[model samples]
Target: MRTYLEVSGGGVMRKQPYVCGLDAAVDVIDGKWKVLIIWALNHRRCRFGELRRLVPGVSEKVLAQQLRELEADGIVHRESYDVVPPKVEYSLTELGDELNTALGPLGAWGKRRMAVLEEAGQD
Candidate 1:
């Protein structure tokens, strides 16, 4: 186990422990919707409604919460515009783009595994 330091709201530092680099990476994207959100925003920025349509099956509330979490984690960037109807667009940060690139091999492996499972009549 290794420890990392994080600052609290009270301006105090605390130690957080993780087993390895993968553990720390997984901690940033530990939810069902986060990866999908990142994927959806990979190519372009999207408004709330656009994101909802792109990521089918996610409720508005959950999507909003997940976006907030991703923003706090520094993986997503939220830009607000001063317009008549109030415009907000979400996009991936540079860190998020790197994370997406890292996930490519995992996604390919999953595709291969799914084919194997389907051939075995298990999927």
Candidate 2:
């Protein structure tokens, strides 16, 4: 078993035995419902309960977990207001917006692949 991972350009061997930046990036965004949550916040900011309703079938625990993770990863921003009924909202950060732009082509490719598969199945 290989103990070290190598980076291509720098001839650098990571002795820590961990994933590189790209792998970490993929890991952060990867989940059954993560993209959905990201996409929901793509257009506008939303509150916690609103996000829960926006993303169907996600339990409160799961949604909260995912949001926390996303926030930690710098993909989402959370703001709280001190009011009688406290208000909080979430929106995509600058990095999040860049990621959303990057994901668009990938989503389009997946859509095209699915359509092709469906057409093939109909034959």
Candidate 3:
């Protein structure tokens, strides 16, 4: 027989959907445009059209889908105005802010790696 030990922290068991930390993070930012969406909303809140403009090559349907997934994962907050010509804005939640900070070093490393790769390619 196999047994799994329940992990409880801060006096409460986390309700995380993924069993592994990396898996959980990957599950939240799985799609191609999700990380870009997170990066775009890291500093400022943006509307649907704004996100579409910021993330080039992404279609309207894909953006909407990614936003919905992010919102579901509790990484992004969606605020809708109760006015004519409806306005909706998205911003990162606390969890998302932490995620952005966590990914910053990785982003920098990727930049350095890209530069090295470019140089290597030229050789």
Candidate 4:
């Protein structure tokens, strides 16, 4: 029986045997920019420059890289239009939507923690 699943990104593929479901899930969103990218695309499809604006701190290169990784992980869909300037847009896939839903509780917890910290003058 196979114990590990295959994952690919940025033209590289590998098999990872995760100890738990959280481990597998965290692996997909390991970077700082990925979750932000997912969040930015959760509502609607966005073009590259628009994504950069929505994400605030992400550079054009990093946004493109994160989008590629998300697409490779089956969490994002990229559509291209062969217009004069060649337009492209990114949106969350079904898997990505589910992933965002799964993150709701985490977001709530973070918000609560942030509030507590603010009350304690920690931030």
| TM-score: model 2 vs. ground truth | 0.77
Give the top-scoring candidate (lDDT): 1
Would you list the rank order by TM-score, best first?
4, 1, 3, 2
Q: Taking the tens digit of each residue's C-alpha lDDT, what string does model 4 give over 2-93?
A: 56656464653434777788977988888889887888887699999998898899888888877888888889999999898899989899
- Give a tens-digit lDDT track for model 2, residues 15-113: 334457666557668777788889889969999999888899999998987888788777899999999699999999998898888789889998999
lDDT of 3 at 40: 93
**After superposition, candidate 4 runs with Cα above 4 Å error:** 1-9, 12-15
1-123 per-residue lDDT for model 3 (tens digits): 333433443232234556678866876787799999999998799999999989999999999878877787788999999989999999999999999898899899989999998999952
Please tell me which predicted candidate would have the highest TM-score against the true structure: 4
Q: Candidate 3 — which residues are off by over 4 angstroms?
A: 1-19
As for candidate 2, its clashing pairs are: none
Scored against the true structure, residue 4 in model 2 reaches a CA lDDT of 57
Model 3, position 19: C-alpha lDDT score: 64
lDDT of 2 at 116: 92
In model 2, the worst 10-residue window by lDDT is: 7-16
With a 3 Å backbone cut-off (N, CA, C), the pairs that clash in candidate 1 are none
Could you tell me which residue pairs clash in candidate 3?
A: none
Error of model 1, residue 116, in angstroms: 0.8
**Prediction RMSDs, each to the true structure:** 3.5, 7.0, 6.2, 2.6
